[model samples]
Target: MNAPIRSDATPRLEDYPYRLSDNVRFADLDPNGHVNNAVYASYFETGRVTLMKDPSKGLVPDGLAWIMVRLDTHFRAELHWPGTIELGLGVVKFGRTSVTFDQVVFSQGRCVASAQAVTVLIDETTRKPVPLTDEVKANLKPWIRRGLDLYQRD
Candidate 1:
């Protein structure tokens, strides 16, 4: 387990310049008739992958991989099927070898679920934590948010 270094604050989705939209599938619903809680993580993944996987973005290198270390999710509201949702993600904190992402799921402009995840970059072959290079930082610079902690709960 890696130690988390709390920054001055977390950032919001709107604070970032980019986001991804995905739809809830009929099969995603649980017996309770709403999107299962488990699906929220996948939605978060979609947004993160979209940003990180693009070589043009330079967020992640070709031979490097990111692994999730921790995730804190708050299920504020339920999401129904037959609907579209937007996932917005931003950098909460940038560590020596890890980046914490704050993300929210919105349905019809209403926040349904939000999460904060800590991910570490590792060398694909060695599978060891690697420091974020200057190039990676340059790519991620556009996504960093400095103030207004979205993860703070009432």
Candidate 2:
């Protein structure tokens, strides 16, 4: 049996970290009645924090700051008002002081936009990049999926 393909052709939870769903609000819509291009940033940021701040796993360090070093987004189609949107987040790379996240946003089971970001672990006070600790890595491991298990085919 094959898993259903998502609208944006992204991998499933087996290939990703966590998935979150949201609804477009009156405040989120532009005069055109569709979500604005910039709205995706806030949507992406929402899932980013949740994935790292899971209280059970607690990836966010007490004295550390996980700051965004880079962000890139791709829009597959325009998303309009008053609908359900799903966000998929995964770690594609983990470094000594940073991690790369692949975040995909979907509506009605189709990907409307996606983004990739590089986040650096930093000293909360000084805001400087620091070495990633094993404790943080340990909590993050369960969320890491090898290769492209999200893909339906080899």
Query: Each model's TM-score, in the order given?
Result: 0.85, 0.82
| Global lDDT of model 2 | 0.75
List where candidate 1 sits over 4 angstroms from the true fold: 1-13, 146-154
Q: Model 1, residue 19: displacement in angstroms? A: 0.7
| Residue 84 miss distance in model 2 (angstroms) | 1.0
**Candidate 2, 121: how far from true, in Å?**
0.5
lDDT of 1 at 15: 60
Question: Relative to the true structure, how large is the alpha-carbon lDDT of every model?
Answer: 0.78, 0.75
Best by lDDT: 1
* Model 2, span 1-154: residue lDDT tens: 1223333555444455578888887788888887888888999999888887777777887898798989888888888877888888876667779877778888877778888778999998997899988888677766554453322422
